[model samples]
Structures are given as structure tokens and as C-alpha cells.
Target: MRGLMSAGLLAMAFTLSGCGAQPESHEAHEAPEHGAAAEDYERGPHRGRMLRDGNFAIEVTIFEDGAEPEFRLYAYRDDKPIAPADVRIALELKRLGGEVDRFAFRPEGDVLRGNGIVREPHSFDVTVTASEGGRRHRWSYASYEGRTTIAAAAAAAGGVRSERAGPATIDERIDMSGRIEITPEGKAEVRAWYPGRVLAMRAQLGDRVAKGQALARVESSHSLQSYTIPAPIGGIIVEKNANVGAMTGDRPLFVVADPAMLHAEFFVYPRDAERIRVGQAVALRSLSGAARLQASVEAILPTADLASQTLLAHVHLPASAAEQFRPGMGVEGSFVVAVQPVPLAVRTRAIQRFRDFEVVYAKSGNSYEVRMLDIGRRTPEWTEILGGLKPGTEYVTDGAFLIRADIEKSGASHDH
Candidate 1:
């Protein structure tokens, strides 16, 4: 009878267990949903995301409103507001390819602020430390601030070229405004050999003639016979005063100029006149930048312009540049005055403007990092680097503007 009762009790226990098992399995699946909600990130009073360790927390933000990018921190303790003076905070950021930067914060009212500008790219693995009550707590997190990536094939198609930064000879140049005129060597004045009457005029104004070509027939006063007056050089007749019956004397009858060769004249300020010298290389270009010619400082006039107080410089243009230019056309000349050797330099095309800073794209393997540069002297081809870049570092020398466009397209708009 006892065995029969035990079997009946065991069956009753099994039935009760089966009834409870279904709800327990359902609750196990629902627990994960609750845990996910708890793991969601929280923000601080500054509206920046917060990171916490023990009873201390810090909210980091980049503040830029008509100012440089600065790291602003808000501190908390046990989920409550903490006095900035009670704790000391520090930050160490490690960028891609092993660049590291450290910052020490000082208390400012209810928050702590970095002493210097927070150099961009803003993308980095950040480690922050908060010390209070003789105890230190550190929090580490990865930030994807203004990050963009490009494929190698796309970069190649864009004409991108990479080069290592190194020393370069930077030529310091002086800019001067000038105009093209017919050089004295390319001009001629036609005059009669002796007093005579112009029997006939062969060449008129604006007519092209060759050397020793007859310009007019003259009846010589010494002899009744007529003689031909010849052109002194091959050029266009710019001026004519001789008529069919007019008498020619010592006065010039025509002005001829070889418009193919020109001279560029510029004025140097009194302060810069001392540096002016003969034989210095000069580059003359049209105002539109379409036509360019190389010349040299042919002469420096001793006399200065009475009104402008400037000395005159003459640059001789070659005849081959005739088609691209003409007499009386305006031009600008770049005079290379000094050649400076810079310890570190990069191609001028690599530089771009990002916010308030001048930046260059630094390359490492397949990645590019936006690097801010402090520059010194510069030439048309290269620029001297004062800071923010190291020697032997590879950088994008061409197609940097395309990369900048891609970075903008990626919406990598971090605060300045």
C-alpha cells in the first residue's frame, strides 16, 4: 500500500514541475531585452556622452564657436555633480599609426578645460583619468570623430601621389607689377641719309616691312635724281610723317618695332631697391595666368620715379613668346631674390585650408590623416614646415583637394 502511495506522490510532483517550466523559459528570453536597455549610453549636462569608473564620471566635448577646438570636461561623482576643484583630470589620446598626445586640465568654475587647442582629426582612442580623494580612476573609449576612408583604386584614379617630407630649397621671391613694351633693341627709327624731297611713299602706317626694304622714293637736294629710302630693320611701321611731296631732313620719318620681342618694366619700392641687381632671374606672366615667359633683369635704372619713389627694373622677353603676348600688354614678374634651405619641407600643392588651420593629408599605408601644419617661408613649388609634421613622414602631394572633397562628403564635420 506504501509503494502505491509513493508512485502517486511522484506523479503529482512531476505534474507540478511541468506546469512551472514553460514560464521560466519565457522569462529567460525576456531578461536579455532588459539587459540591453540598461547598457544604453547616457549623456551629461553638457549634452556630451559620458564615461564612468567607480563613483567618478567625465563628459568630454569639443567646444568651437568662433574659437579654436577645445576639450571641455564636466565631472560627476556617484551620479551627482562634482566640484571641479576637488579632482585633477588628464587625457591621453592615441591616433592611428602611433601618434600620441597628452593634455592636462585645470579647474574652471564647474568644469575642467584643456590649456591648448585640441588638434584635429579628433579621431582617436582616448584615455581619461580622474583623481580625487587620493584615488585615480581611468576610462578608455574609441572615438570616430571626422573619420573617412578611401579605396586605393579610387585614390589612384584621382591622380593622388605620395611623397616623403624632407629638406628642400625654398626660393624667396619678390612680386612686381609691370607692363610689356617693345625693347629698345627691337626698335628702329627711319631717317633720310641727306636732305631730299619724298618722290613717292611705298610703306604706310601699320604696314610690315623687311630690312633694307624701300620705304619711299626721295629726290636728293644735292642731286636732281631720285633715290629710294630704305627701312632700317624688319618690323611694322608704327609712325609715318613722310608724304609724296614732303622734304626729308635729319628728322625721323617712320618708327619701326619688332613686336615679337618685348620688355617688361616694373618699379621697385625705395626700401627694396637695394636688392635689385642685374642678371637675376625673373618670371613674367600675363594677368590671366595663361601666358608665361622667362626673362632676366636686363637693367635697373638709376633714376627713381619722382612721384612713386620707386626705381625701374627692365626684364627682357624673348622673341619666341610673341604669339602669346604683345606690346603694351600688362604682366606680373616674380623675382627670385633668395634661396633658403629648409630643414623640413613639403610640396606646396599638398596644403589645404581646414577650418582655421592649414592642413595636409598624411599617408600611412592605405590611410590618410588630416594633419595641421605651422608653416614658415614658402616658394611656388615648396613650403617650409615649422611644426605639426615630422621629417621622413609620407604625405599626399597631389589630388589632396579631391581627398578633402571626399572628407566633406563623408560628413566628417568635427568641431573646429
Candidate 2:
């Protein structure tokens, strides 16, 4: 497939190089060496191509002020204006992919107007024929814009790659901020069963302990018997407030939290509270974006924060994420509220601003041209194409800016 495309591109380049005026012929003939230089031809007062054949001349122009582009031609003889009805004209445009557009003209006011509108990207090889006074005149030229050709090798080296435009699933998400915390059921506070003196302290802050494991030895003040203080849960000791000879009262002596069981608490303001619900999927990343994972909302606390008046949405994390995530670490989350399937879409990164339109470059062999788009729903990853691009069309997906730069370097004109 690639070899065939390369051969086609080479053939297109060869054909484009032979662009010039040719006499009328019934049989296919080899195009003469390009000698017209018509692309740089003189412009008439209407800013249209001025083609002369001895004493007869005609100016070709595309007028598109308040309407679609349509052909408007002016005729002349002996360098003087001539009646439009006295001359007959026809135009044929051969586009890049061998598509041909034929236009017939009729007198409209002082100029001859074409029957059809000229579509965008305005790049083609044109053949024009005019008849008057028993004589025939023909002209041909190449008028191209917003297009560039790069060799496959150069394109690959420049990171240019293409993909077929097609349907995609877009995930609509709402962003929120949150912090990782230990769930209530995953934390335990250790306090002496009876008023006692701390006879011995075994566990230290940040120590990992097993459930019911001995953490300390305390002597009861009422019975003078020393009792073992065991850990209430299997987790890391986050807080320790006991020491040898320290008297224990109602205060907790140690706080153990199960880091393996963690949840992220995202704040939901009034504007978004109605949209949040348990079981919705969420993508979470650390504030620095160095760690990321997928989880689902496990619960929504009924009460809102006293200061911020924001509700809490909790998403439980897997034990595997504990290595990268820690309690109180700030995280950013994207909650998927909806998923939509679009008939045609492109990667959001592929879309670029060209003139006043958001566009993506469509690929034909090695030739790349602008495709003005009508965009609809968009996410960070994909954008729905409402119009202006055909399904299954190959388009620049990577290195689109490189193609744009090459076209801009040629200074392609929007002239009619």
C-alpha cells in the first residue's frame, strides 16, 4: 500500500510540472513543456487572470464576496472591452486526486458567470477554452494554495504520521481536587483499658504493627497489675503519645491507620453536587501528575464542610497504589459523567487554527491540504467532527504543525 501511494505521489508531481496552455485536441496528447508561466500572469482591473491570444483576451476570476465562489469572466478584443454575450467560455478543474469539476458560463451583467460554486482548498489544475468570431483560444495553469508535498522519508523523519478519521468514544468529564485519606473503618485509636502508668513502650511512631500484636505494657493504677496494650488494627502507627512512666488517662496512647485501605475525598460544590453519584468512574492523579490510577466513587458524605460548604465524594483506591500515594497527598481527578460515540472524530491534539477555522490537514499521497472543520463536543483526548471532513479520510495525526509550517513557507495565496 505504501509503495503504491509513493508511486502515485511521484506521478502527481510529474503531472503538475507539465501545467501550461494547450491547444484543443480530440485525442490525448503529451502536455508541451510548461511555458505559459500563467500562475504569475498579469492581473486585470478585476484582479483576475489575464490571458491573451493575439488581439483576443479574457480575464478569469472567482467572485465570492457574500456568497459561494462562482466564476466571473471578462472579455476583450484589441485591448478593449467586449460584450459578454458575444463570447462563449468553459472551464474544467482537475483536482489533486483526479476529481474533475466542469463549469458552464452565461452572461450575467457585464461579466460571464459560472453555473457552480468553487469549493475550498482551491488547489487544482485548470483548463480554459473561449470561442469568438470563428476562432478558439485555450489556456491552462496550476493554482494551488494551503498545500505542500513532502517526501515520505522526510515526513517520517519529521514525525509526520496519519490516521483514518472515524468514529470515537468521547468521555465527558468533570475535574475536581481532593486528598488521599484513611477511611474511618481503616483507622483505630488505642487507649488504656483502665487508668494506668506506661510501664514499657514497644511500638514507635511510623512502626508497622499487626492486629492484636503487643504494642506496650501498662501497669494499672487500681490493681498494680501490668497489662499488655495490643494494636487494634494491622497498620502503620501514625501517632504515639506514650512513654515509660507516663500516666495514661482518657487520651489515646497510639493511633494506627491501615494505609492499604485508602480513599480520595473530592470536594463537590453546589453547582456540581447534583451530578456526582456513587459508582461513577474517576481518573485520579497526584497533584504533581507523577502518579495516576483509575477508581470509582465509593461514597458521598451527606454533610458538607462547615467552612467551604462543599460535599465530599470518596473514591477508594487499590492497595497497589499505596507505594505511590500517601495519606494527605493532594490529587486531581476527572470524573466521567457521560460517554458519547461520534460518527467522525479526530484527536484533539491534531486540530490546529488555520486562518479563522479550526482545521486538520487531510493527506492525499504526499500532499497535505487544509480541511476546515465544524466541531462539536470535545474532550482532552478526542473531538467530534460535525462536518467538513469525510469519514475514512487519512489525515495528519502527528506533526500537523510541521505540515502547516511548510505550507506557510510557500506563502500560498487565497487569491481568486
Candidate 3:
């Protein structure tokens, strides 16, 4: 009677317990009927989507937890786990770049296991097939938009930086060898007006003389009157043929060069002559790499060198480079062939190959997102951003590969 009384009390408590229990949520009740409710799509046991076929459902996930990523599947029938040996599975992935891969699974202990690892970044259209009891079921889905995160400290240590994208000036250049020469307007040759004897010499070789400064005094043989020969330009005397009492005929007494304004003569091949134009910026460098100058194309000689078939382009050097240059110095010039302005640009180091697409690491505070870019024109140091990036936004400029390596190591490669 005591045992009967206690059993009756337990039954009465159980009946009262039902009155206080919480009812099942609407989502849980609808998942089976609608084949994995929207909220539970990525909330399954494997953190993957569940594909339903008739009464059986398969949850697919790429298991990359601290190891190489691989496809793992869970099978269920009528809300009960199905035995692995009862089903055969195969997975096929078609990538965006027209690449296709297939994986087959076999029974391994309690679950169906893939024969090999799944390629990263797990972004593709997936087709999964399962055969059970001599009947086959198929399901399809797409995943992996290419995303990842990194610690702020790690990113800074890896040399990652970002900036708002902005416009940049791009100059297309044509490289060619050239030589320094004296500008025609900057050279002067002082000569006697008539046949005479040089009575006195005021200037010598290597002497700085100003325009209208007397270089030599000469006594004409006809008039017997002395006349002074003045330097036509302000420069150092590079040539002095006059001596005291030396007879002057048609020869010049002195040659003066004003090197502050000089010319870089570019010997362009006939094939490149048509593209050469005046007023374009040119960068000149000595063969020894010790000297550099900025100049502009001033003229293009019409005649081509008969032997070399090369045309001459004269570039005017700035006064700043005058002291470092000398006539006949061998140099190289990069002439601007074209100039373009890009509204958005970034350092070339920011770009990296992530799977089938060219990508950049976009940073947002402590996290980094993989941004696929549509690229356009490219220069040596910068690349034009046509898409995938916005102006005034910051991104990784250096050490981007560090982020990529970390993400890929985390099974985010997503490339099949």
C-alpha cells in the first residue's frame, strides 16, 4: 500500500509538470515540413545546411577545425540518425572559373566520410548525391563568399596598412638612351670683325665671362685701329684660341657655354619617332646612375641618322641640374608618351591572388575581409581599381600575404 501510494504521487507530479513546460518554438515545428527552416540553415549540428530528400535529410559541412578542411556529412531519417553503412554519398563542386571537382564517400565508423580533403575556400555550386536501399537522392547548394578575420595586433605586426582610395596620375613612359649637349641658344663664339692682330687678351680658358665682357682686343690690319671683342653670352670660356699679338683671321677668339640651360638629345628609333612629341616630361639619368635630371621634350629633329635610322629629340634640362651635367655625357631618358588619371588606385603590394580571383584584404577595425577586385590599368608602383574598392576606404598596403596565408591556413582558400 505504501509503494502504491508513492507511485500515485509520482504520477500526479508528472501530470502537474506538463502544465509548466515551455512549448516548442514555431521554427522547430516548421523545419522538417519546409526542409530546414531559414534561421536554421547554417545552425545544424555541423554548422552547415541540411538538404532534405523525401523523409531523409543530410547536413553538409566543411570541417576545418585546426586541420585540413574536409567535407563531413550527417545523415538522418524521420528525425533519427541513420547508420553510415546504409548510405553511399558523393559530392561534386563546380567553381566560378569553370573548374569542377568530385569527391566520393564511404562508411567510416558512425558517419559517411570523404575519401580526400575538400579544396578551400569552399565557394562553389555543390551537388550531393546519396544512395540508400537501391534508391538515389540528389541536392545542390552554393557557399563561401570568401571572408575571414584577423587580430588587430597581428595585422599591425604583419605590416598591414590601409587608406582611402583616391585619384592618381599615371604617366606612360618610353625609355631610350640619350646624351647631354649644349643648347644652341646657350652657346656663343666670339670672333674678330675683320682680319687683325690680337693686341691683348683679357680672358683665358676656364674663365667665367659675362655677356658684353671683353675677351680680346684686336688691331685691324686695314684701319690699324684696336677693337674689343665681347663675349656674346655669360658663361665659362670653354675654348680660347687668342694669344697676345696673335693674328686673327676667320677663327673665333673664344667659345662661351652657359650650362644653366642644356639639352638632352634622345636618339629614338624610327619606329618610336612617331610617338615622340614636344612638351612632354622626361626623366634623364646618367649611365653611372649618379646623376638624375627632369626635363621636357623641346624639339624633334626631322632628319633621321642615316647609319642608325634614329631620330633626335632634344629635351631641355632644368637649371637645377645644370652644375651636374656636361656636354657629351651619356645618359638615358624616359619620355612621357601618355598620361592618364585614375579615380581609384592602390599600391600594387595590396593585390594578391586568392583562389580564382585577384583580391585585396579590406580591413574593418579588428577584422579583415577578402575583397575581390576588378582591375584595370597598372603602373610599376600602383594599380587602378575599377571595382571591389571604394574611395576614402583603407586597405592592406603591405604584408598582405601574411593575412592571406593566415586565412588560407584557416581553410579559407575556397579554391577548388
Candidate 4:
């Protein structure tokens, strides 16, 4: 009779166990119900999908009401966000209800921080979705704070990343691109200055000739006979289009000038127009990023090209630049437009960009304090400062790239 009772108890226990088991398996099976999301991803590049898992998560943080949207979801691996090139990231994103948005990530240690915007102000939704190995996961927060909360979080961390809104620097120098061209400081136009045919021509590039030297004898239209026209100045024949038989039209056929009086013309975008002047001294350096050649500003065109919209600035080459600085050579120049009157300067590589602000890690009291400044004037070698910093500031100029790259990597912005 005990064995019969034990059998009945075992049957009851088995029945109870089955009832609990079905629900968990059912929940697990139903958790992946993202058919709508999978369809949304199918419309994206590579048919991208929103997902979430142990290795990945999405975070958002909003700051300004009128600012551009700045939030992103991330796909992390081993507690780190994956680069786009290393993973399948969709370039195009679609919002279903037009409120679930992706936000940029700011990584601090192993955890990622972000700001999500609520279009309704004081009330919004946060959605985190990512896909991995053909699977998707999603989660959302409707109680997340709006811009004020984001600003508060940024304030607790010092600031978001602007001058008025956050910690700022006095330095504003950013290394941009520039090109080289022929300078007109000491230029001479070898024109048809009179028209004639090519006769007994011996002028070639790099040929050193004296003043009043005959370049070519021509049968003048006025004389109807061959006459000699000597060079007005002692210089080299830098450019020659006329051969022994080339015809001369109204265009320049040969360019003769003193190589000693050379200048470098740099093509710049209109953004730099206000920072340059006609008489200010500037240092012309090589794009190889070395301070090789020195120069000074000699001229700045009052007007810029309306179409290409380039600023034409003239730099005078020193006597030491003779015969070495050729036309069409690429060089960069730093013009000191406005000065704090003998302020200190340092290499541009020593500076780091913190959000929308410029920063340089200064070695103060045996520690590296990243100081933000209002960047003043800048060249490839040194960045000038106006406030929030000092001159002769000791920092890492050669190896600061790693620091900047780290900040960008942590920010997880597509631009980085």
C-alpha cells in the first residue's frame, strides 16, 4: 500500500513539473518575435536589423532642443563597440513610429553612456535594438530624461562639449590642407611683350643668363627683318613653350625671372580669408611637416575667386630659398594675423579635441591635465592660444594621436 501511494505521489509531482516547464520554454520561444523588425531591416542596406544581446547594447543622450540629432545604437563585442568596417553596419536607418531613434555612444571604461531625445519635450522614448548572426533584440525606456537631464549628466561630468556649455580652451587651431603654386612677389612676364617668330632660340629651363642677354632673335613685323631683344633683368629661364620652330601668339611663350626672388602661392578656402593680411609675417613650411622654408606675407587679394571661391595670398621667399623652391611645389604656411603680443606657441600634434572644444594635455605638477583653450593662430608646427591656457605648456606633441584616437573611438561617432 505504501508503494502504491508513492507511485501516485510521483505522478502528481511529474504533472506539476510539466506545467512550470512549458511557460519558460514558451517565453523563450516568443522572445524573438521581431518579424516586423526583421522586415524593417530587410529594407536597409545588407538588410540590416535592430538587435540586442550580452555582447551589444544601444544608448542615447540628448542635450539641446534645436541641435542636430546626436544619438546612436552600438554593436559591442567583448564589452567594446565594433567599428563599421569590421562589422556589417547599415548606412541607412529607418524609424517605424518616427520616435525610436539611434544615438551616439560615449564610452567610459567598460560601460557606454549616451543621450536620447524626446521630441515631445520632458517625455520621450528610448529604443535599443541590434542584430547579430541573423537574430534581433530590442528594449526601450519611456521615462528617460529630456535635454535637461542630459545637460545635467554632462554638467556632472564637467560639460557636454562647447565653450558656453562646457569646459573650453583658448586655442582654436586645426590642421587643415593647403596647396602650392607660383608666387608673384618677384615675377616677370615673358610675353610676345612684342610679337615675333622663333629664331635662333637657345633658352631652356634652369639656364642661367645675364641681364641684356639675347633670348631669341626674331624677324620683327615692324622691321620685317631679324632683330635682337635682350632680357631686361638677370635671371633664369624658368618656363619656355617656344622651341626652335614654335609659333608665338599673344600668349606668354617664355617665363624668365631671378630664381632668388621666388614666392609660394597657396590656394586656400575662404574660411581663412579673415586670418591673413598683406604685411604680416608668416612661416612657410614643407607638407612633409617640417619647418624647412621660411617666408612672409607680401600680398593678399582684396577679392577672391567667385566660382572656385579660393583666397589668393602671396608669400615672399627668402634669398636662401633660391633655385630650390620650384613652382607647383606643395607647401603650408602659418600666418599670424592677430597676436596676443608675444604669446607662447607649441606643435599642433600636442593638442587634442574634446567634443566641440580644443584641448591640450598639459604636464602640470607631475600630472597630465587635459586643458581646454580658445585656440588663437595656428601653423602645422604650433598652435596659438588666447585664453584658458599658458605658453610653453609641456605636453606630448609626438604621441597625442593615440589620445585623440581614443576619444573618437570612445565617442563612437561615424566621423571618427
Q: Which candidate is the best by lDDT?
A: 2
lDDT of 2 by residue, 1-416 (tens): 11213322332121122123333222333333322334545778798877788888888888899998888999999979899999999999987667799999999889999999887757677888989999998877667666666667667766778999999999889999999998898899999989989998889999999999999899999999999989989999999887889999777899999998899999999889989989999999998889999999999999998998999999989998899899999999999988889899999999987777899998888777788899999987899999888899889999898667655544556675
Model 1 alpha-carbon miss at residue 297, Å: 0.8
TM-score of 2: 0.84
Q: Per-residue error at 183 for model 3, in Å?
A: 0.8
Mind giving the per-residue lDDT tens digits that candidate 4 earns over 290-406? Answer: 546656677777677899798777777777775556656687766666544335555566677655567765532222234557766665555666665544445545434433443
lDDT of each: 0.74, 0.81, 0.70, 0.46
- Candidate 1's C-alpha runs over 4 A off are 1-41, 45-49, 52-92, 100-120, 127-140, 249-251, 413-416
The parts of candidate 3 lying over 4 Å away from their true place are 1-161, 166-169, 288-294, 341-343, 348-363, 366-376, 385-393, 396-416
Displacement of residue 181 (Cα, Å) in model 2 is 2.2
Q: What TM-score would candidate 4 get against the native?
A: 0.40
Question: What C-alpha lDDT, on a 0 to 100 scale, does residue 228 get in candidate 2?
Answer: 96
TM-score of each: 0.73, 0.84, 0.57, 0.40
RMSD of 3: 17.0
TM-score: which candidate is best? 2
- Arrange candidates by TM-score, descending: 2, 1, 3, 4
lDDT, residue 45, candidate 3 = 69
